[model samples]
Structures are given as C-alpha cells and as structure tokens.
Target: MFNKKHYKFNLNSTFAKLLGSYLIIISLILTTSSLVFFRKYEKLIVTQEYNLSEKLLNQANYYVDFNIQWATSFLYSLYLDEDIYDLMFSQSSHYKKNGISKLKHLNLSSSNIDSIFIYNKFDDKFYSSLGSPAENYYLPSMKNIIYKSKNTFTDAFIPSQIKINLKNNNITKNIISIAILTSKSSEKSLSSAVILNLNANTFSNYFKHNITNNSNLFVMDNNGT
Candidate 1:
C-alpha cells in the first residue's frame, strides 16, 4: 500500500525551515560583503580627489608667487633706473617730461603692466603713463598704506583696492600694485614713490581654470581678507 500523503511537502517541515535559514544566512553574507566593498570604493575615491586638489593648489600657488616675484624684481629694476630717479627728483620740468616719455617706453616693455605712476611728495604731483588727472585721485589713497616691505606686492584685489576708470580708455580692471620709495636718505616724508600696477588676470584666470564645479579656491594675503 503506497500512501502519497506520507511524502507530501510542507512549508512548516523541519527541512523547509532549515533551507530557509540557509538562504537568509547566505543573503546576509553577500549583503555584508557588498557593503564593505562599497565603503572601500568610496574611501578610495575621496582620497584620490583630495590628492588632486592639493596638487592643483600647490601648482597654482607656485605660479602666483612666481609672477609676484617677477613683478617685484621688475619694479626694483625700474626704481634704480637713473632716468626714473631723475624724473622723480629733477628740478627742471623739461627733464621730468623726458622721464615721463621714458616711462611710456618702459611701460611697453611688459604686457602685464596696467600702468606706472610716480608720485613726488616734494612737488605734490602725479606722473603716470596714463597722463590723466585721475591719477591724483588714486595716488592719494596709496599714500596712507603702511608699507611693510621695500618692494613687496599689494594684496590681491578681489574687488580691486584701487579702482581706475578713465574717460579716454574707458576700461575697468583689477590690479596689484608695488611701490618703491625713491629717496636715498632716511627721511622718507619728502621722498618719491614709483608705483607699478600689474594686471591681476594672470592669477584670477589660473584659479578659475584649475577649480572644479564642486570646489572653490581662494588666494589670500597676510590679512586673510
């Protein structure tokens, strides 16, 4: 007598329960492995991104500092120029005019120079390549700055420390400035300052190009402004 009910399958059977438990344990193991792999992959991606950002920042910093060094060296060279010194201290207007013409020629030597101005505290006059009365407005503002170095760069102008808007040129742009006192003596109150203004586009463009859409980079001075 063969009875089929004796061999009938049942969900509540011990064997069925054991199979279900095995599947659940296998699922948990697989899930845990996948989670661990995902975390490791995430960490690797983060480390790679951090390394890239740091490298780019270092490169940008190098280029920026190099440009500033070039500017300061250029300014110092111009400061020592006999013609420039004569222009700053000469009593004759004709000699000063000649110096101004020489300044125009010097201004053309570099494309980075926005403008060069020489302020003689003795005569209370502004001599610049721009040859515009607007220099008077700008030169006075720089006079108040407590200079920390003989040939040091001014702070990067996020908003432009000295704004220039000339009617003839009609061009508005940001600039970084470096000024040198022309007097040889200790009494600097009556001395002249030769100021060289550099276009800030070189630095701004590098930062803009290196930064990603998700990241931001800032170049700050000692003041951290």
Candidate 2:
C-alpha cells in the first residue's frame, strides 16, 4: 500500500497583483458610465425647459401685438370717416348735432372701447359718442396734448393707479387713452383730434381669464406706465 500524497495552495505576488488591478479597472468603468449618464440627463432637462419658456413668450407677444394693430386701425378709420370731416369745420350747430347723431350709430361699440371723443380746434368744441357735448372743464387739461401730437397719434392720457369714478363706480383702475390729429386741410392743418378711451381691464382680463393660475398679466404702454 502507498501513502496518500498531500496538496497545498500558494499565494504568489504576480497573481495577487493582477487580480487587484482587474477589480480597480472594473470599478473605474462603472463610475465613468454613471457620470456620463447623469451629465446627459441634466442637459436634456435644461434644453426642454428653455424651449417651453420660449414658446410661451412668443404666444404672449402675438396676442399683444394683434390687439394693438386692431385698435390702431379702428381709430384711424373713425378719424377718416366722411361725416366726421363736416363735424370738424361746421359752425352750424345743426350740422354738428347731425354729426353727433351719426357717430352714435357708427357701431364702434367694441369690448375695449369705453368712449370716443372728437375735439375740433376750429370750433373749440368736442362731440361725444353719447350724443352730447363734452364738458368744457375737461377741455383745458387735454388741449395742449392734442396740439403737441399734431398729425400724429400719441397718448391722450397716461395710465395710473389712482382711484377714479368710471361708469358711475368708484374704483382703482387703468385706462388706455389715445389721441390722433384729424386731417383738416379745408380749414386748418390738423385742426381736429379723435380720442379713443380703452377699457384696459377688459383687455387685460382676456389674458388672465384664459389661464388656470392666478397670474397677473400687465399690458404696458409705450411709456411703461
């Protein structure tokens, strides 16, 4: 009978060093993959957020610009109407009365328009859309403004936060008032003005009511007031 042979395991430098290096390399690869994925995901999220913001801004601007163009064109047409010319120069109260009557029936009643006034420099008179003469007291405050913007359109009244009576109600509100010098080649050059008073609340509410959030949308004037 032969004795059984015994076997023993050995720990060598070459094998141990190679195993340690392999583990370190595998750990490094995993860390690099995680870092790359995190960076790309963060960039994607940022890009999406930027695109959304741009789209919203463009939409807001489109609505604002459209309203402005519509208002401007309407005012121009009112000033150029054939009957308004007679009202500007006529000394006869009857002609002025007839003109006022015609203006009331013009169907200029839009959601944004509160009232309209035609001021004649020659007669120093004003006709209202209400089929009456505007009070003389309100004339002095706005006379110089109409003259300064001769043959052009400008802000007739600046918008403010001050409380005032509107439609028989005392409240704080903003109003958009514009004045345009009417053509008067037959009498005096640019001797008349057509003023349009806009209901700013109606215009601004159009934007706010469409949104679910209680966000305020401000329509700023050229003066930023």
Regions of candidate 2 where Cα sits further than 4 Å from its true position: 1-35, 105-108, 130-144, 155-163, 166-168, 183-190, 206-225
Question: What are the per-residue Cα lDDT tens digits for candidate 1 across 49-72?
Answer: 899988987888788778878887
1-225, model 2: which lDDT tens digit per residue?
999999654456787778889989999999998999999999999999788656765776787677678778877887777677667667778667667876676536676765567877677778767542233334443455565563567743434232545467765545566777754223333357777666778756766755546656565546685
Error of 2 at 125 (Å): 2.3
Model 2 TM-score (2 dp): 0.63
For candidate 2, give the lDDT. Answer: 0.65
What residue pairs clash in candidate 2, if any at all? none
What stretches of model 1 exceed 4 Å from their correct place?
1-8, 12-14, 133-137, 146-171, 183-190, 221-225
TM-score of each: 0.77, 0.63
Candidate 1's TM-score reads: 0.77
